[model samples]
Target chain A: MPRKAADEIVIALAGQPNCGKSTLFNAVAGFKVDVGNFAGTSVAFAETRVTFHGRKIRLIDLPGTYSISSHDLAEKVARDFLLSGEVDALINVVDASMLSRSLEFSVQLTEMRVPMVMCLNMMDEAQRKGMEIDTSRLEELLGIPVRTAVAVVGTGIDEVFRQAIRVAGGVVPAVEPRYDNDIEQALSRLLAVYPQALKDALPLSERFVALRLLEKDEDFERKVGASSPDFLARASEERHRLAEREGRAETLALGSHRHGLVLDLYEKVVRHRRGNVLGTREKVDRFIIHPIGGAITVVGSLLITFFLAFFLGNAIAGLVDVPFGALRASIQAMPKGMGPAVLIGLFEGVVAGAGIVLPYLVPLLVLLAIFEDTGLLPRIAFMVDGILHRVGLHGSSVVPLILGFGCNVPSIMATRTLENPRDRFVTMMVAPFVTCSARSVVIIALAGKYLGVLATVALYLFGGLMSMAVSYSLTRSKKRKSLGVIMEVPPLRQPYPRIVVRKVWLRLREFVLVAWPVLIVSSLALSLLSYAGADATINGLLSPLTTSVLQLPAAVGIPLFLGLFRKELTLIMLGAALGTDAIGNVLSNGQILVLVVFTMLYVPCVATLAAQWREGGFKTAAASALLNLGVSIAVAGAVARFVGAA
Target chain B: MEGETAAIHALHSDGATRKRIQSLGLFEGRRICVVARAPFSGPLLVEDVATGARVMIARDLAENIEMESRAPEGR
Candidate 1:
């Protein structure tokens, strides 16, 4: 489609993975994107409007990609947008610390010939590595405006945007990258054979198309082949000629050729003086990544996060309980009828929301954010790959699985990084069973409240085991295993308190805005239903399973039904349904355990199901619901039997 | 293979995996070091000696990538 805002200048921030593009984007766009140390954190582009230098600027943070070669969906998203020609100006953010690899990507960006400026981000990182870069030299070398920025500290951020604004307003002087003489001849030869029809059809510049074609980019090759198979044939011949000269695949030959130029440029511009770097961090990793120690650290850190959130949430819950109880007593004193019931419904909704938000959701999100920002998630992924592989998952699958604990929506979304459709399907299928924070609230409030901490932990372990079993069963029939994980382990960084707070707020706000309102409205509706004596019919209808199989109180039917709306509602609505927020008053310990287990593994919340539908269509979503229903029934039934036997 | 430097000789993996690895700057003839390995046949942390960038390659993929032993380039 055409550009929506004709008058506004559209600038896009693009860079390789974890090179601080989101950091720089947020610096100017004011926290429109999530910034994390993990690669592929921003799986989708984030866009915002800003009035910069007295001009209406639409700035977009594209997903960070290693190259425009488009190996996976993230890279394809970035490449397609950049080549869409909608970006009026581009900010190529490069990590000053990883200058050589970053510059290799910068070299590819220059090939696009868009109006661009280079932002040398993380200059402090480079300084720590003892690499002093000559910005002027880089500017002269790349023939574009270059600026230095430490985005975390807000240093040189505005100057980077100022340069981008200037460059967008003016002409981008064409700066073509020159390769070695032979490869240059080969590229021109391939370009000469490029069809005029294809040239206009393809959005990329002719030289870039030629280079990517030479590199055997699948997307470009298909595009070119569709336009002119004869051109593809001729291009293959030219590739063979170059391969003959280089004695390797033409793709690698071109890649190595570009790397040679980038290394040359890097040497000319970067002066490396000795500095103490990586000593302490490496020593630390030696233990953190040790065969035995790494496993312990992973399990230990996760347990610590769990117990901390659990006890901390319980403590906060205790503090909030007295006020809510006092409010309830006053409401009870007012009257006993429909109006009082509705008032109590609304009040209890707020109380239940506060109960979950303060006690469970907030603490959990904060801890998850800390794990994410500290760059520890990938390490956990690395450690868990072997175990996950036994269940037919790649190591990088751990990222999404861990994120599933926060919410299933982003967890399903994060599966985009996995290139294989089967891998993504398997991950998504198990994601809902991963005990999201909302479900954790149900488990902790019900099981932890009465059944004790051991029961809560056991419930979590059972959920995890069920998810693994599901993944294994799904992948066992497939003949091919998932392609092995190849992920960049970003350098560990100190989690910035500011960023962590924003990240937690971003997640917590979802609970407050989306889930809390749902909680309130559902509580009110359930109260109205109970006040109208309609819940008896709904509860009677579901009694076959809830009453007979799971052996829970029939009043739990509405809560379990509405729990499909939001898992936390199972806990929140339980108070409204049972006529008391103190669930233990109604439920025996085994009954609560059965209820939490059924709630934990049953059909995911509506938002999660919607996300599943979006990611994998209706069939996958149906599979998830069916899978959860079947598993929850089977397992909870066994638990009910076992608890009764015990 | 921990803490040993080697030159990448051949990438015997299939198209997509090879492309993914190469996109991160791993290529034939470039020297890389095995920085760390996870237990029970997990991924290995490999670093490019030239760029100082680290990536975790699954043991399966690492197996397909033939690495010739090389003397460590003095740090």
Candidate 2:
């Protein structure tokens, strides 16, 4: 939130997707940068400060974009930031092995006339594949200082920044890219007649303006429109006539022309051993994404991750449970009638806040972040793209739903990885149907106790089917067909430990700050209601829904109600009301199945509702609650009737 | 063309899809390869041979990305 000082030099790190831009930012700026991979990870630039060459520079980690085309959100961010004129210089990070492709972007930066430097990152990987890039030759051709780096291991970073500081100080002049003679002649003509933009378009000029118009970039046209309505028209006419003269579209001719120049430059400097370049990545991807192998790996990896979070989260949660249990007992025993309701409320709040949720939520979020950081998740998304398309969601929805098995909160948060709003909403709503561990405690307890094993298995399978149906129905629209799923598959790397820990700590802090307050306060209120002897009144209120509709006895209402605050509480209170853990003492087998089904499908916990309210707004939260209520009640009532008849 | 290296002949995609692909360094004259396709009618994995940037195109969109094979029948 702190503003950069006026004198600090602002340097933007721009690159194609997964080009180690962020990896380099962390190496230089010291690991505080907010990290995300693939496209549009950071919608706007994430700024960090580092002292380089005796000057503290404000480094902006721009989103990964292939070019400054205004098609996607991330590209728009990169494009607008480059033209913003706030940047003192640019450091274009090019993946070293992918030199010719990355150079196409480098050529644009040079043409924009921004003082620039090129960071040829991933030099080690380039070498492993037998690519020998002549950095000196590249520097000679591009007119910008070039530095080589293996950013993940932090090599050549200091030299990159040292040269960046020197460039920002105006030691380097902006370089212009060469184009085809026909387009070149048209560019010169356009530049001659160009009406300058009215605003202070520093770092952009008549030449860059003319080229942008030639590229037929619509966003640039709109910006330039206020001053020159006829300017683009004249430029378009030139481009059109030129295209007619050449036997191709003007843009393609110019693109290939610019690309030809880049290819020629790199051709002089780089040597490659072809056919041998498809190395470990291709090998690993072959087995892992192979339909049979992919299915096993995906299923196997997810099962292991869940078992780890579940067992580990539960074990760590024990440390919280004991102290909070003692604290609650002491608070409950406080002097008679001294606002016992308040005291009970206070005690319940502490237990739910510390003892119940955090145990599972912390480990789950950390593990999910690890999957995200390692770039393993998008591959899972890629494999599942076909199945998920049937549900009106993208492949990325798989990551959040898998995380939803641990807890719905972070899984909902994980949907931010999904770019579309409707996708996020539908994913968020269906995510709760994954049978989170909390609800698992209640379902396993009740269903396992009364109906034995098979019905419980059937119950879980039911939840999965409902999740797909719900998400599909909520998000399907023919008009808003997804723009196709184009995910960047980052090379598998060791997860950065610092970033992983920091993400866990940051998101856990949200649970502590936002969700726990709602949780604790509601826990207190629920406990206070029982203490105030309002149990009978509550049972009466729920009678229509419970006995008449769900066909469960009135005694089940309080546990079902308290389950909203903490799902495990349903079992605890049920044991207390029934006078034993043997739930079959009061309920028939059929009645038990209906009750557990309703519990599993009913509204998400109060804390989860609070999260929905925060992330999706009041309308979304209300809609989800209504959806859960209607589905569970109707299903439970029909099943209860079928069971009674049987 | 299934396993061969090819040059993008011409893109038949609409505006949004075309511009989006262009941002991923896909355009006319770029060389590409069809790496593999999932069995039972899955997405086709295509890579820009020059960049090593891979994209998985659904069967429907593959029709729009017309290509002329560049590599010979056998390696």
Candidate 3:
């Protein structure tokens, strides 16, 4: 939306990836932004309004980007927002620990001539790194108000925003960073030849235009081409001459020029006190990233998370089961008629949702939040790159797969980080098999309750293997080698308990608001269907596969079939279908295992299918659904036969 | 590969990969140290000495970026 209020300051928080831009924005915006330690975590922009000193501040949290030149989707989102000319001021949040690299992006931002405040964020990290940044010196050099902040702890954030508001309200002209003589000369040459009218027509500064053209920024080049085709010819000729003189591509020359400038600037402002001693962070990081030790840490963490969720979920389930069981018995004892039956159906839905799902979901989300905040996901991605390569994927795919454990919708969206379409498609296709938290609810509640913890762990392992096998087969015919991963491994930070709780509540709120309503309505709808005796038809129709092939009860057909809408429905509606919440009494251990496997492998829920359609197009989504159904039948059938044999 | 500083010779990649590499501050002439190398040819974790930015470069991409190793600097 365009700024309707002239007094409203539209300030955007911009920075390099994993530099705490979101954290700072969250600090001011009251936890509206998603803060994760992984780069590219903020794929989209988040905007909120704050009343700072009675002045409305429209705060925008942009996706972290290393440079405006890259065409990655996340970077594109950030670049588009910046170039949109709507931002009144920018908060260039720099990771003070990595001052030089962060300065490169800050330098790039200055070229836009936007009123900006330099926020030396993560001051604690810099201090821990034994580096002291002279903020005043940085302010003096950059000609902008610079503030130091440890955003995580809420240190210096209000002052940083105050500085930004002052910078926006006042005439604080952006100080253009100067480059080496060669780049300056080249830039001047290009600007001198460029038409004044055309330069003024563009939203960016004339110098930024010249630099972008020389650096071959496609979006800028296209804009300039649309304005004046004649200027493009001159720019390319100048670019060629500069590339020849630099003995490299014009893009590389521009980047190196900035690199040299930033290094020189770094030496001027940063003082290293604890010279060369690896801090405890680096020491622990080394052990964590070690091949053997890292493997142990990674595997052990997963096992611990699984067991904790299993036991904790069971305990919660047990606590709630007593009250829900009494409620069910009271409803059943009311009468042996349709009214009581339907009442029991509605009651069972609430029981399954509140008692069964939340028990497992709450602990799992808490752990996932801890994992995300701790910055371990990227390391896992790095460690698994080689293994993924065997399946025609790479480390980048691991992010989406790991995220899939929480839910599939965002996980599919996370595939935007993968550059290759083939990689994205394969990852999207394989990701749904990763057993999202909703599926985990079913697996834990049913499998954990009846089959034991090892059986549940084995089932999760089986899902992982199936995902790998499916991805391998999907890419077997395509011989194009996957691109190697180039990902930033952000420093691990202690997970703040408050933020973790907030994050879990955000996810849990979704289940309460969206999924619970659907659960209750669907439960009621199924009850009505059974009242009309239509569920018998659904169960009978699916019985050919559910009963004959999987050797499960026909009544389970309704839950299994309706589960395509929400995986939890299969478990929620199970008691309603089978006439009892005590599932072990009716279904044996082997039968529950077969049902879990089938539910896990079946077509992803409606939300997931919609996400797949949006991300991979109709054909990919349809093919995926078919592939899932095919795999579920085949695998579940085999499990049933094997169980029978045993 | 560990405890060595290397000046990047060149990135023998074109298009997006090269752009991504350069964007991450892995430009030619920058010195970097291999901090960790995962087993089974996973990825090499390299820290740019000048910037203190650690990047995980997959072995294939690492193979393409030529560099000349030097002895570890004295503390």
**iRMS for all predictions?**
1.2, 2.4, 1.2
Better of 2 and 3 by lDDT: 3
How large a fraction of the reference contact set does each model reproduce? 0.79, 0.35, 0.80
- TM-score, one value per model: 0.95, 0.81, 0.95
lDDT (tens digit, per residue) of candidate 3 on A516-632: 888888888788888788998888888899888999999999898779889999999888888777799999899999999999999999999999998889998999999999999
- Residue lDDT tens for model 1, A1-646: 3365777998989888888888777777774567767777777778888998898998888888888876677777787887776788999999988888888888888887788999999898788777889999899889899999998878998888888888884557356778889779988787777788887777667888888877778888898888888888877777778788868876676877887888889899998876466677666666777878898989898798789878998999999988889888999788668998789889988988886556888888888888888778888888888888888876778889988988988899888888888888889998999999888888887788898898889888988898889888988999986778889988777778887888888777777888788888888888888888899999999999998889888888999999888888888888778877777888878888888889988999999899999999999999999999998999998889888788
Looking at model 3 chain A, report the run of 10 residues with the lowest lDDT sum.
A167-176
**Model 3 lDDT, full chain set:** 0.84
Clashing pairs in 3: none
Clashing pairs in 1: none
Error of 3 at A453 (Å): 2.5
The DockQ for candidate 1, computed on C-alphas, is 0.75
Stretches of candidate 3 off by over 4 Å are A1-7, A169-174, A275-277, A337-342, A644-646, B69-75
DockQ per candidate: 0.75, 0.49, 0.75
